[model samples]
Target: MRTYQLYLIDDEFASHYFGKERMVYQLFKDYKEAVGEYKKILEKQIDFILKPIQEIKIHQFISQYLQKNKDFYTNNGLYYLEIGKRSTAKLEIHERCLMLKANGNYEAETIFFEVLRKTESSFIAIDLEHQRCGWLKPIKERKFV
Candidate 1:
């Protein structure tokens, strides 16, 4: 028999070393139940990922998910928050800045990046504005669209 479990992944510290492993939290057996709880939790904060797991390891699952959805967050070439201003960096942002989503409509002070190519600690990201690629720490800000 197979069982399902849900994990609460912290989006804030997702890119730092050991962040993903340490942030995986909560366990639920039902997907719908978990989603319902996640929705309620989202009302209070946007920096949490509620992911459902079957058999795969948490780290593996998150890595695959981020790889698959890399395009969604990179459509507008991604943006770095500078006092709430949408700024594009030719390379990578040096200072810790919030990654903007919803095409800059929404902004959260969380680490968010689209993974083009990945390693254990970082990934290559494309700056569509400059048509250049640079290394960035990968972070999964959301579990779903």
Candidate 2:
């Protein structure tokens, strides 16, 4: 049986929940406490930390999964792939409209919209004069059409 572990960290507190085992481990009250527990676990279970599993953004997971694997409502269109050590891919403007048109799959659309909204919110939160006019302009201009 496949098992999954969910580590929740909020306000420096940490809690671990195991899906298959149906076990909850509240190991720490803060990051400091969590670090101590992690160190202790590291001595015995170093292999567990190196396991391969998908780490996804909560908002983008659904759309990403569907798009990549199932091709759910995804049309043949140009997409933007960020270049760097930590690269990211995003649908272009035409791709966005195609996704919007495919309302038949509401779940995928909903997830994509949520991801879009979050990205837009973060972009809007930036300092306009410094970030938008200076840094973002060149990046936006370089975007793939």
Candidate 3:
């Protein structure tokens, strides 16, 4: 039987569901590797995951990030957060959120809202904000299969 893993990436929150523990490790390796893999998957499957979003919405999302963080932007609206800068990088906020999700360290709803609030508040506080940015919007509670 072909095995599939379900990975959830909501703003910052991310989770993976697998029938086997070993498989999860193989696919994700660790939180950092998993985030990198998720980015690759998102790029490769952009058409599919982004299908529900209108072109303008997609553009707006990418544009906002570009405007907010310039150096990280690459062509084609893809922004990469460098590894050494992960701690304070706005892009890595979502990665930290994902790490929290993977470890079950935070409540999904709370973490989602907190990340949003912090991002917005931090943006407002600084004359020029330089940090990783992403948020988790609330969703229906998920139960692992």
Candidate 4:
């Protein structure tokens, strides 16, 4: 199944669904499209606030990343954050990726890159953003039955 999620760019930025929804980034077709439209609002800014969203293809087993530090994929706000806190990073899942939100949105890709730094070329991490099908493994290892 293909769905959309949002990782707030700033940790201090009041999360829209925090507490009420620990994982506020729900998985649904409408939410996905809504996020796409929301992303546009952030794009209009000349300076930019939210981090670029990474496309996670849970069904296809494919994932996307920023590829560069502080680099993002779109101006759209949905893929990014709502811009409540302009200078924080939140929502990084990987243990090594943990950092103060004062830095910026601690996103999945951040963890992905962090993992790459700590592990061998073969190590891999399943984008936990998927919720149901997420794990970290090495490229050389095959655990799937």
Candidate 5:
């Protein structure tokens, strides 16, 4: 499981630095505490960004905040991997799901995995065929004609 931290970013300060760097006012582990302080800052009309972050390899934390399932983002659903014609689908394993940057392929087979756990970027799934568990993300490139 990954730990989360909230950061208060100063957009005005970052603008001076060419937007490549941001000035963080503070880091808080508690969401409510951060939000409470965030509200206070908001009342002052100051520019800042408050967000909860997990240390994914690439930062993809642009999702709505939910009170429940803070540890891991919950998005329970089925994941389907459709192998293209003359192509393959595969499942790759890593120390963490965030580290996976590519999708796997299997030849001539359509695989369905029941999603046991879901996050913003990846899914913890069990393969129905081999009864194996691994990290997977749903593919959105397929189109139905």
Candidate 6:
């Protein structure tokens, strides 16, 4: 038998669920109260009404987070080591589109990921196999009329 707990595997997943990656599983300082609530949720026993947690805009939090993570700010590039066959293509495409839109502001927006088999390659070996799969434009099929 195996057990599993809900854990966002990466920044992308966290970003999708919690509005931002930096918001991953933080304690509310009142450890007992927070854990109590969590346990209740798991046990389906939360009876007492609790105040709603206020929501902060993801953009605002992302700004603060990126400031702290200077490397992420400086890099300004998204990478995909592998395009999993079972992965959610729509989500990946959404992330890439966001990056592409921000290209004007950052000027280094690119989704650099490896193709099948090869760990890396020269610039000439572009992975056009899935160009239409997760980009702003259709893969290499621009009309020239």
| Cα error, candidate 5, residue 4 (Å) | 3.2
Clash pairs of candidate 3?
A: 89-132, 90-131, 90-132, 90-133, 91-132, 91-133
- For model 1, residues 30-126, the per-residue Cα lDDT tens digits are 2224567675664334223321222233234334654443222222333223324442221122221222222332222222333212222333232
Better of 2 and 5 by lDDT: 2
Candidate 2, which segments miss by more than 4 Å at Cα? 1-75, 78-99, 122-145
- Candidate 5 lDDT: 0.28
Evaluation by lDDT, superior candidate among 3 and 5? 3
Angstrom error of the Cα, residue 96, model 5: value is 25
Give the per-residue lDDT of model 3 (tens digit) for 22-122: 43334343332446767677455422321121334333544554445433343443323222332212222221122211112223223223433433321
| Alpha-carbon RMSD, candidate 5 | 16.8
Task: Go through the candidates in order and give the clash count of each.
Answer: 0, 0, 6, 13, 7, 0
Model 3 compared with the native: what TM-score? 0.26
Relative to the true structure, how large is the alpha-carbon lDDT of every model? Answer: 0.30, 0.28, 0.30, 0.30, 0.28, 0.23
Error of 5 at 45 (Å): 6.5
State residue 17's C-alpha deviation in candidate 6, in Å: 16
Instruction: Please report the TM-score between candidate 1 and the true structure.
Output: 0.20
lDDT at 126 for candidate 3? 11
Cα RMSD for candidates in order: 17.0, 18.4, 13.8, 17.2, 16.8, 19.9
TM-score of each prediction:
0.20, 0.22, 0.26, 0.21, 0.18, 0.17
Which candidate number would show the highest TM-score if scored against the true structure? 3
Which runs of model 4 end up more than 4 angstroms from their true locations?
1-8, 14-17, 26-31, 34-145
**What value does the lDDT take at residue 124 in candidate 6?**
17
Please tell me which model should have the higher TM-score, number 3 or number 6.
Answer: 3
